[model samples]
Target: MKKFLEVAEKLAHEKPLGPKYRNRRLVGNFKGRWECHIEPGWLLVYLKTDQEIIFERTGTHSDVFK
Candidate 1:
């Protein structure tokens, strides 16, 4: 299997869900125990195994958890 970060990168080539979340950070709602953060401001999304951005959203300045 691939890590979260890798998954985010593959999203484009494998299953790109672009524009759908441009300028907005949509939660992946990943059903796992790992913690991730969205970078809502660069049109790029990411997930992390520990603390690295896998996919980032480039827009809103709010915490999805908040």
Candidate 2:
């Protein structure tokens, strides 16, 4: 999970992640949140605000979304 932590740390600092992470804003019911691919099938979802960055979930696409 080291890579995941690294990405999380960057996010907590409000730093922009590289394109390899495929980071993007979420929409639909998940609006206001953000998602990024941590690996081939792994993903991280979180919400960021001025005060804090709230990690929502992390898992494979199906694992987290389903």
Candidate 3:
């Protein structure tokens, strides 16, 4: 989970992640949230506000979206 934490730290610091993370806003049931790839299929879902960042979930695409 080191990679996940690394990305979380970056988000916490407002640092831009590399393209590999594929960070982007989400829609549908997850509207207003953001998602990023941690590895091939693993993903991290979160929400960012002026006050703090809220992590919602982390898992493979199917695992998280299911």
Give the Cα lDDT of each candidate.
Answer: 0.38, 0.91, 0.93
TM-score of each: 0.22, 0.93, 0.94
Candidates arranged by TM-score, highest first? 3, 2, 1
Better of 2 and 3 by lDDT: 3
lDDT of 1 by residue, 1-66 (tens): 133354466443545444433423344563332232233332333444544435433223344233
Q: Which candidate is the best by TM-score?
A: 3
Best to worst by lDDT, what's the order?
3, 2, 1
**Model 2 residue 40 lDDT?**
77
**Alpha-carbon runs more than 4 Å astray in model 2:** none
Comparing 1 and 2 on TM-score, the stronger one: 2
Candidate 2 lDDT over 1-66, as tens digits, reads 899889988888878999999999999989999999988799999998999988899999888888
Model 3, C-alpha of 64: deviation from truth (Å): 0.8
Which runs in model 3 stand beyond 4 Å of their true positions? none
Pairing residues by index, what is the TM-score of model 2?
A: 0.93
Residue 8: error of model 3 in Å? Answer: 0.8
| Separate clash counts for every candidate | 16, 0, 0
